[model samples]
Target: MTGPAYAVLAGSLRARIVSGELAPGQRLPNEQELSVEFGVGRSTVREALRALASQDLIQTTRGVSGGSFVSVPTVRHLSAHLETGVALMAAAERVTVGQLMALRHLLEVPAAGEAAKHRTDEQLEDLRRAEFDPAVAVGEATYAANQDFHLVLLRATGNPLLEVITAPLFRVLATRFGRDHAPDGFWSCVADDHAELHDLVAARDADGAVTAMRRHLDHLTGAYQQMDRLSRAR
Candidate 1:
């Protein structure tokens, strides 16, 4: 009739961790102590801790000096779960290339405008370092650089939530496209798009950034749709 004892304990602990009641790397009370505090058995305490650990909120150590400790949630840590979920959805065919393309346009069009407004000099330097050289052909290196530039652009929005959501979507596309060679000049065209976007971003022209981002997504949508067609024909 009621929530399980372990879930109640886990929920309480999760709330504490998120509320700063339990600081990152702070060791939790021992199982016996937790059991007494929550008025549950040792097994219930363990189950609760295990639940939090699975979510990467609490970590357990196996030595006498070790117990459950609050985990520091980094961007990478949070994005890892999203990446896994996206991959599964793609594999299950719950998501289509068309859908991914549409989602990207929705998220990234605003992201470009935001990046132009909020991006720092250091982030701009990172974009330059990514090097949108037109001479580079499509391959692993070009793919990697393109992915980096887009991820950096998302991060440049100064919006962690946007970065977390779209970075993994970028990754899902990269993984899908990485499986094959592209037509000649494919990467060069990609580089050209990045170059145009970079200049707009560096100019801090929010309107131009939005326009450029939309155009780039339009190109990418066509490319992905072509790939989908090719896959279906074979």
Candidate 2:
């Protein structure tokens, strides 16, 4: 009943969407109806809808039967949004490099184990296709391959949540500090680790995959931390 009218309306709508009170693809009330119900102007309702749309909570359409509807978020959409948030937090120093590495260890090691246990033939083939020799692959091609390898490994776990939650952290770290500041031979080491992990997963050695992933993270975390330090010194 106080504060900015549009912001208050947006917050209420956001809570409903988050709590599933407003189901995905559910159409919202028309502008006039919302305005009357909330005791706000039509412009305020429009602004609130715009705000929700910006957050990917709702989408709008223009046709005879179209209006604003709650959004059904895909894995890629969720991951990209989270990646933006992570990048912003890192930029603000609200989250440190240490915390990110710790989270990756918590999420990815287990994900590798799961991949070993649950990976399908098609997922395994995809993982194999993601491989690249850092020696032979150059620049963005090598970087893209490394990204694909990790992404495919996560996908192999057969858990969309793992891919959604963990992919952004690696992507942010890689873009911000992981690539340019790496010491010599770092990517070569990464390629080797990926190969070892793939073999373990392909053999369905869950524990071995976990151990290999742990070791691989140990190698990567050091490089990430070193890069963080260098970035600060500049």
Candidate 3:
């Protein structure tokens, strides 16, 4: 199919999947059936399916009872789109990683303070577990849990808009500069910082929590800067 036709079909299919009209593991209509329904050729249906597959919304298999099936969205899929947008904004050179870190500092420091004033005991407990869980290693699982800790703080601010604004930044940071930009002990240090932040917030020491969070993020920013410098030196 042509680009516009392909887009229409892909979007329609994606809407169905997202709205739960077509669920995970559910089979999509066969190409012939879809073509007839959409009043398009089999080739058009195939092209649309290919587009959906690229977005990880569907997969195809060959054989009886095998066809296009909806696939579950994953964090990696979300992060990839965010990374692309960030890279575009960075324009390969004009926007330094330092600028991104500065933006984060500006938003997160005050948000942490607000969160301290507004957070509930349940939210703090969840953050505590995510930070101090002994079983978490320096791998994908640890990284995800760490991200969740920050997300909880953002949510605790009682500002849905702030959470939405910071979501993309977290995704970009995780995708581009996760553990690879930090030292082996970085995760452990973060765990300690998270614990302290939780304590400060739980005590309703808003200023203290804000300062702690700022210090922790500053350390992270410095680590990324060092990594950038080292890469340039190489």
| CA RMSD per model (angstroms) | 2.8, 1.5, 5.6
lDDT of 2 at 81: 94
Output the worst ten-in-a-row residue range by lDDT, candidate 1: 176-185
- Candidate 2, TM-score vs. the true structure? 0.94
Scanning candidate 2 in windows of ten residues, the lowest lDDT window is 175-184
Every model's TM-score? 0.85, 0.94, 0.61
Residue-wise C-alpha lDDT for candidate 1, range 105-180, written one tens digit per residue: 9999999999999999999999988865757444677778888899889999988888788888878876764336
What clash pairs does model 1 have? Answer: none
Q: Write the per-residue lDDT of candidate 2 for residues 1-234, one digit (tens) a residue.
A: 457999999998898899999999999989999998999999999999999999899999999999999999899999999999999998888998889989999999999999999999898888888888877898888878888988998988888999899999998888887467788888889989989988999999999999999999999999888988887788
lDDT of each: 0.86, 0.91, 0.79
Let me know the TM-score candidate 3 reaches against the reference structure: 0.61
Put down candidate 3 lDDT per residue, 1-234, tens digits, no spaces: 346787888888989999999998899999988988888888888999999998888999998878999996554566566657776775566667688888889888999999999999898887776675534565677778877888889888987666655666756655554436566566677788888988888898999988998999987787777766655665
**Count of backbone clashes for each model?**
0, 0, 0
Q: Which portions of model 3 show Cα errors greater than 4 Å?
A: 1-84, 133-136, 231-234
